[model samples]
Target: MTHFRNDMENHDFFDTNIVCSIVIYEWANELSIIDFKHIFDWISQLVGTAPDSIQLAESEAKYKSYKWKYFEKNNVINRREWDLIAYHWFRNIETKSGIRVYCVASTRSFRRLGIYIDEAAVVDVIGVMKQISRTIIEKVEPIYGYGAMQSYLDGPLEYARGINVTTYYSHENIFSQADVDTRERISAFGSEFRKNKRRLNEKLRDVEVINYISAGHLAGIVDGMTLEDWIISGNRGTLNKEGEATWVWRIPDEHERSQIRTDLIRSGLLVVTI
Candidate 1:
């Protein structure tokens, strides 16, 4: 069985030409939410422009709260510090160089900062990851961290023709305490996966791996992989002073992608039910 997303043509579908990088973090509850200014500012500098639109989530409580709406950039940026009490901020900022950047900041349990750029900008996703290590990980010391380049629409066709590159980053032992914490979480996830009665083969049925292959030619980078194999791949990982550790491969196409999706689901890092 294979899976396919029928809504790929929807408005919210990722733009094929857009390149995105995502940083995953265990929420920093101890840090002040106000630090969002510094984070967004860093993103603005990277894109070389102020944000055009902003969305905020101030109250955790759903009652009497409507802060998820998009607010004018000027209205939010021009306000005083005391007024910027939102727990989450999302921005859409673009540059004249034909680069589009989208940044999201949050102080919630699982914090993720996503950076989306136009392929034309040719921004270094790893550079962005290194900056995140210095500015966020060093100070906040998150329990676990991972960064990866995402697959966009038309990924199979684009990569089959040598259009884009796919990258993965998983950290181990960057900080003593955080390393231990991340290991424990991964272990627990592994245990949970084994306990599930659903067969691993069956789980693969829900997601389609879009690929293009010709006679005697396979354009996929990953041949065959299991859940544990993917989890243990992080053990050999190491980060530099700037906290850089990445695994890069070209032509991930649909086969490798399907394996990745399966790994993420089995590890509980992502969720989808058929």
Candidate 2:
């Protein structure tokens, strides 16, 4: 009853959870492992423009595999169909049609889509389809959790939001069990770490720096600082506003860049990058 349903009206779709429910489950073993390659093939066959977009998405999440088959089965409308249905559910036929750009394009060329991001849309038509009433086909997995994105702090968490979305994938504030583990580990280490530095200090003997860096290697040295101070700063000091653990401290010119790096090695703060 998903894509084939009749209250069809201007006929299109809807959704609340992310397309693939991969990130919702806290445990890796809970999901059915499926190859993204098959999804890519299906998308490619259907639209001819998904190769680039899919490849980009895949590369972005290289740390873990991208699974699509389970999502296909859940919606009964194929992933592409689901996207159209979900967007339709979110916006009306008139409103969705007026839009020129979307994260997921419908066609492979501009001729088939409205305009904006430059690349041909691969999902334009699918998103605007109006001929089918939507249904879940089957029940979504009973064990599901919500992942909140923002400002939900004042209210109940996502899981308590009372929406039909039993699972959330890409949003923030959704803490999976793995997240809990990492948080617990950090918590366990917190008290000891806050007790004040015992051996790590301003003394010059402990820090290390390096030279001959690769492009964007984020390793460099500052002037007049002992290696120990460098280590202290890098390990437990002001790491800019973003908390980027790796960085190259500012040096004025190429010569200064070279000199400070050498000085750091001489000062002896451990210098290793890889």
Candidate 3:
């Protein structure tokens, strides 16, 4: 069995502890497409793991051929070689090493490449990201590129249920119980943030507000801090990855959670209505 890191430093968000170390990139075009072979090589060197199963686009179940060595035999499963030629894209990849990669094609109008790293190998997550970044053909601005530690909760916004807190921005990345139509969508490079600056300043006047876009590790954004460094700074229970996920996470003491929340708010990272 994989023994995940339990030390205080890793206690923040290691895999299967109900906590996940995740980095997501949403590209406007197909220019940022990742080279899966590069990723496989990196993971193999990083943690000695390789892809074992793949979930094709629109497929209901993951397909795995024990006869074929996914890593050695074929660097990556091209759509044409696979029996399912109708599916021309990769939806998700499940690796024996406990890391999962999600790639949504541009045909959906929203292309994204998301990597969920195992907590044990969380230290070099940015390395995995940098590997993907090497594929960028042109200097393209991302719709959203951020890393975050997500916890699997019982329900949407379960931590703040019943609280009359107002949410400023949300998207498919955030988990919320509010009606979908009521939630607001803010662009990464838009003037909406500037326009609402005064309102945010007044509401969180004394509080340091950290945007979700900088939640984890983003190249040119972390300010020389590594993913581990960011995780050590504070806890982020405000963000969640999956609601019905069966994974279990270690629930820190209330005082610890409160302190983390307070620290993040002070750093302008998290904002709550109390």
Off by over 4 Å in 2: 1-248, 270-274
Q: Summarize candidate 2's per-residue lDDT along 1-274 as a digit string, tens digits.
A: 1221223333322222212111111111222212223322333343332221111122212322122344344543333311111111112345433111122211111101111111122233333221100100011121111111111211112112111222334234463232443233333323322343211111111111211111122223444543335535545222221112212122334454345445554543322110
Candidate whose lDDT is highest: 1
The positional error of residue 251 in candidate 1, measured at the CA in angstroms, is 15
Q: For model 3, name the residue pairs that clash.
A: 17-249, 18-248, 208-268, 209-268, 210-268, 210-269
Model 1 has a clash total of: 2
Candidates in order, TM-scores: namely 0.41, 0.18, 0.35
Candidate 3 regions exceeding 4 Å error are 1-18, 28-37, 58-76, 81-110, 120-143, 153-274
| Model 3, residue 69: C-alpha shift (Å) | 0.8
True-structure lDDT of candidate 3: 0.31
Which candidate should be chosen as best, given TM-score against the real structure?
Answer: 1
Task: Give one digit per residue, the lDDT tens place, for model 1 in 1-274.
Answer: 1111222222333334445443333333355545665666665555444554444544323212122233332345334322222222121212212124445544542233434543333245545545644565444543333333434442322221112323322132121122343334334434433354323221221222211111111111222544234324643222222322212122225565555555555544331321
Model 1 spans with C-alpha error above 4 angstroms: 1-14, 27-29, 59-99, 109-111, 121-129, 154-274
lDDT at 208, model 2:
18
lDDT, candidate 2, at 51: 25
